[model samples]
Target: IGLSFVPDLKLANSLYALGSCYNTIALIYTKLSDHLRALEFHHNALAISKRIDNRRSVAQSYNNIANIYQDLEDYDSAMVYYERSLALKTEGNDRAGMASTLNNMGELMLATNRLNEAEKFFLESLEIKSESGNRAGEVYTQNNLARLALLKKDFPGAEQYLDITERTAQELGLLDELRVNYELRIALLKELNRPADAFRYSELLMVVKDSLMNREKAEALAGIQIAYEVSERDRQIAFLEKEGELRKSQLALRNTLIVVSLIILGLVYLQFRREHRNKEQIKTLLREMYHRFKNNLQLLSSVLSLSARELTDEQALQAVRSSESRVNAMALIHRKLFERKDEARSINLRDYITELITYLIHAYGYHERGIQTDLSLEPVQVDIDKAIPLGLIINELISNAFKHAFIDHQSPCLTVGSKLEEKATLNIEIRDNGVGMRPPAERRGESFGLKLVNMLMNELRGKYEVSTQSGTRYVLIIPL
Candidate 1:
């Protein structure tokens, strides 16, 4: 129809219709797991939508294209398009569109495993929907937020959010909300370990689904009657000709779809290769950085050692040892990076920590007479960025306790351990079998190193408590 129409008479409308058709077709391809074909149709829709100068439609094209990328798990590409869509929505001041874009952004964040940012965007959209009395959209966003809470194991919060969606949907008779509400309620119940409640909601979900099918069948019957009446004359006279045209169109469409699929796959391959190269470059940069870093830390460690040699005073030796311990902690990270497999962002925490402890014990002479460092380790892999700060903090605390806490002692022993606590929290315990801390550690001339350790602990969003009877014990709780 668009091709048959006069360009001057319906140029904008034809372009808009072409874009809509391509977008719809793209979604079907995406659902059928043909991502490449879906991408081609998405581009086609984008072209026509831009031709028509419809900003909202162009934004929609960006969103649909992003959806295909999301399905392929190409988060970087998906994010690019989502930002494009958001920019268009903002430029147009489309409140409803903005709300939708926020929801999409939240979903993309969720996919990338950034739960905090996802919650913020989802709630932001919900707030707009609720204030504008867009109850339907509000229920949709609430449903998404509820699922998010469930994913985070926040069952109570999920239930609370679902309750709001349920009340709004039930009060206003919004069937779409009811469908999602029933299914999500079942999921929340299951996550809460209430199987019976989950089963009951599941039954309700089926009932809702059946009712929707019946309603759709009834509506389709009416639509079919109208369509038959409108096309009766043409249907009778040109039936075989229309059939031949339809068959030829189907064949051509099939061929076009195949070509589009190959194009999309080619594009995906190119994208993957580019990202692989980028990751490799980043790894090389990191390794070079660590090499330089190790050199600097060694220089610092040498300075501290020479200072201790130059000064025979006990107090000055303790200060130099403390600084050396800090340098060693920094040096350990560089050593581990070189030893690790070629990758960015992921590190085996257990291996890294064990190597670090062994290095520290050897460096500080844990096996030496009258000195023993006991470390209890378990399997734990934390992102290196987080683990680096935490390892340094541990080093600082242990060095301080080993120095002043065991002053003039017959023998000295230090222990450090980390355990996985409830709700993904990491609990670290560092203790020393030595003279306890000087009473009112904050008031006395405590080492500046201790002050810095406390600051790093705060930066980790960790909670720390100390106790001393025979020896000093420090407990730290940090959530991952």
Candidate 2:
């Protein structure tokens, strides 16, 4: 009829009618899963629509083509055609068409694991569908949103979305949407631990599947026979035609394989070189940063020493020296980090304590003071942030033990040990065999260093207890 009326109707109207007929036939072919035939008819419709300058028809053709590619799982090509359809639909201000295209794009995004982008598109499509009174499209969009919510583990949100989808699908008699609604409800019920409810939905899903299969089988049996016969004839013709061109195709395939192999080799070599360069760049940058940090701390320590020498007051001089020691303790951490081959942001606590104790013994002149040290540190790793404060606290406690704890004892002994406790906590004990802690009132005047230790412990988010039963024993517990 369209062909018969081509001479009577206006040129544009005749072309549009022809395009519409081809598009309808293409849709039928798509539903029958004859994708090659669908593609052919869609391309024909697209050409006629373009010739007639019918923007809406052109967009429809693009959408049909995109759906075929999506069914074929050629997602890249599907995306290209979908975007083209979207641009044309937007230009024509076709809200319904825009909503449909947006839903397709959302499904593509969801399949690609672009969850956030999929949710955005689904929401926008839902708004458009609702405004246009497209209840069926709205239900589809709601199903997409429900699936997205499930992916995010937002069970309550998914339930709400699915409820709306189910209500809409039932009211409108939309069997396709209802099928998806049943499936999602089943999954949601399972997640909520309602096995009985989930089983009911599962039974409904089976019923829907059986009904759909029966209907499809009835409609498709004759069509499939006809299609198979036609395809067989075409295949025979194609086989005969290909027989003449067999040599050419084989030569082309060989050349293509050689080119692809070379391209793959080139890509592998480039990737290897790029990864190697990136690794080298990161190592150089880390080493330079650590070097600069250590130098800055050393410079600060030198400045503190000079200032301490200038000060005449004994109290002020002692304060400057204490500050310098704390700075040096932090510098030692960066020094070890720079020297180690492992690029981890944590340090070995045992090694750090060993080095720190050696430094303290030499600084306090305890070598000639008959001071015996027993260090038992477990092999534990501490991050840089916690390590700094922990190092400072240990420095203060050990320094006080040497200076104040052993003043009256002829044989001085200091013991430090660390062990891993339950719940990934670290327990450290520092004990000195000397005079125990003083009374609170008497220690207040000389408690400046002890106050610093308290502040450092707070920074570490740790708790400490001091016992003076036989000698001073400070136990510190820190969570990893």
Candidate 3:
């Protein structure tokens, strides 16, 4: 604030340095438990960091923001920032930074209900730290790993990590870490039924905590007092140190943003070149995926195509065709998701179902088969955790109707409707008017596909109901 009106300051450099200063102030405020103030400064830092062209700095800014969000228990925002940090770390080949990002990501996952995924991420990060010989980071990850194991009730695993952490902390003379380790060791011992050892370690941990707190308060107080005599010179020195720290962050941010912006901007110029190159790579990958999907479809199709090949009896061919339509229905959903965006997870069900219906119509080529999709939503998005299995379930019901209900010159038409019943519950309905089941037990309630759908529905904790009014109507409601 005192230097705010420094008329001679270079705008770009000062703006950059100002951001760094804000970051340092934020860090100090954070340790003081003044998170709101810390966040304010961090926001200031981000504002300036974004003004410059520095990818690394932009990433660092994101990390700082994430750290605050995490402290606030805003895990979703924390994970987002952590991912942004990871992307930047990858682009810059910042191994240490990457490890830190991974650690943070794992921590966020652990906070959520993703225990197994959290463990995997934590272990992956631990490996990275160990390989890079970043012992401090290893200690941190180990501490978290130990905590997670304890939460999971794996006392032995928790103890193993705590023992490793203690050794590393001792080597580094990190008293705070040692204090935390002692606390954990005591807890682990208690959990393991070693009462005497737990009691002993608990006493030691208390002693360590008291000593560490005393030492920290004493050192900080003494350091403050010592500066009093040389206050004028020390004030200048403090200003310089603060300025230096700020300048470093500013320069780092500027350099990073500039470099990144240039690289991204340059890519725009080489769009044709990059796309030309990427086109080949994308085609190779997509073509490979298409071939794999086609192969699987072909295998099922071959079993059904037996009549043409004159290899199997009519009954067998009919069974094969039933299986083929079901497989194709599932395949159509996959094709919708894959052909649109990412393939690993999640998709827009409405669009996917729409595309699927189009494919089904073209395949069956039934002129009277008018398909109407009534979605109680503009678009329905669901993760593959629920979507893939649910999609398959829908496919089975629709295919069964296509093969059995609307059969032998029957007017075959199906209506598929999906919507959210609540914030967490999704409702899907498949109805056909061609033919309704006379009795629920007519199908004998047995088939691999139906069994799979039942198992998945059970796993997803959903309720499925089947009814025959004018036609067959199957209703499924799944909790997210």
Candidate 4:
């Protein structure tokens, strides 16, 4: 019919109608999963629409072509066409077309496992659909949202969206949307641990599936019979006209192998993407855990600080302050781990130790007492297992120096240094040029801070030496 009116190019309205007819046929082929035929017809419609400068028809054609590409798993091509369709629709101020295209794009994003982008597209599409009173489109988009919520394990949100979709779809008499609502409800119920409810939905889903499948199977069987009969007549004609049976068989085998290979490659790609996404999710969760842990530690330290302020006894005040400093040290390490996006387990000693020393200096009011500080730190990454213990040890050593060594000293100097001796040994030194203390062997019993330091050292399986020659110097040796 379109070819019959081809010569009358001046009949633009007739040309537009012909374009619509071709586009309708393309959509029919698309539903039948004949993507190549669908694409060919869509292009014909696009060319005719473009020649007549009909933006609406052209946009429709582009969207249809994009849908076909999406079905074929050609995501890059689908995106390109979708963008073109959206641009044309926007220029024409076609709200309905734009909403449909956005919904299609959201579906594509969802299929590619881009949950955030999919949600954005779906929400925008839903808003447009609702504003235009497109209840069927609204139901479909809400169903998609329910599926997305299920994927994200938002059971309550999924249930809410599913309820809306179910009610609207039933009222609208949209069987396709109702079927999807049932499917999503079952999945949502299963996720929420409502197995009895899930079983009910499962039965409804099967009933819907059977009803839809029966109609589809009847249509498909009729089509297949007609196609087979036509092909059989053609095959007979070909067999009589040509003798290339072996060549045809070989060609068919080659095509089958190519298709199998493509399918295998696609599966491999999908698996790799899945693993990569899982790893990214794990990293995000780990960082969040570290952030929360750091925050809780800060809160605990603050409580300790408040408690210390209320303590009248000097010894009680000292104990609370000591606990606060220890908590602060662990919190600082967690802060560093959270800052580091690449790896969560290890932290840079340079920043970690520098910030820790600064916090300790202010905490003890050593700056007001004219205490001089020297720090020579090496850049090193240590695992959290060792870093936490090492941090506490440093906190205890420094706090001990500020309390005992710097008493009644005119010019008190605190020096801290760290070096990587050899490839596998970490050496740390904390020295205070103030009043010296007794030797480790001469000391009768250990303080709480000293006990903590000793326990941490034992945990790290490291060695430490103390020298009271000039003032008080402690050297710690840890294995990498």
**Local distance difference test, per candidate?**
0.71, 0.77, 0.68, 0.78
lDDT of 1 by residue, 1-480 (tens): 212222322333445545655776777688789999989978988987888788899998888888788888998999899889988988998888888888988998998889999999998888878778898799889989988998899877887788778766655555567788888888776665555346545655665565557555754665455445434533443465566654544433433343344445645754565345434444454465566566767898998888888888887777778778777876776677656666443456666666766666666565564576677866767654456668778787776675567777777877878788789998888888888876784556755877777767765668889998789999988887
> Taking the tens digit of each residue's C-alpha lDDT, what string does model 4 give over 1-480?
223233332233456655755776787788788999989989989998999998888898899899899999999999999999999999999999999999999999999999999999999999999999998889989988988888888877887798778766545445567688888887776665555346545655665565556545654665565445545544664574477554544433333333334435645754465345434544554466577678878999999999998999998898899899999998998899888866347898988988998898899997687778798999988877578889999999999998889888899898999999996899999999877888679888888888878877875779899988889999999987
TM-score for each model: 0.46, 0.46, 0.46, 0.46
Instruction: Tell me the alpha-carbon RMSD of every candidate.
Output: 18.5, 21.0, 21.0, 23.2
Q: Model 3's lDDT to the true fold?
A: 0.68
Backbone collisions counted per model: 0, 0, 7, 0
Per-residue CA lDDT of model 2 for 116-175, tens digit only, reads 999999988999999988888889999999999998889878988987787566555555
Tens-place lDDT per residue, model 3, 1-480, is: 212312212444566656656776788789998988888878777777778877788888888889999999988888888888889988999888888888888888888868888898899899999999989789989998998898899876887798778756655555567677878787776776655346545654655565556555755665454334334443554576577754544444444344334435544644554334333433333334544554565576666555435645766665666666666655554455456543233578888777666655565555455544444433777764356567668767776666667766344567788887767788888888866876656666677767867877875679889888888888998987
Regions of candidate 4 where Cα sits further than 4 Å from its true position? 1-270, 439-444
List where candidate 3 sits over 4 angstroms from the true fold.
1-13, 222-231, 234-480
**TM-score result, candidate 3:** 0.46
lDDT of 4 at 166: 71
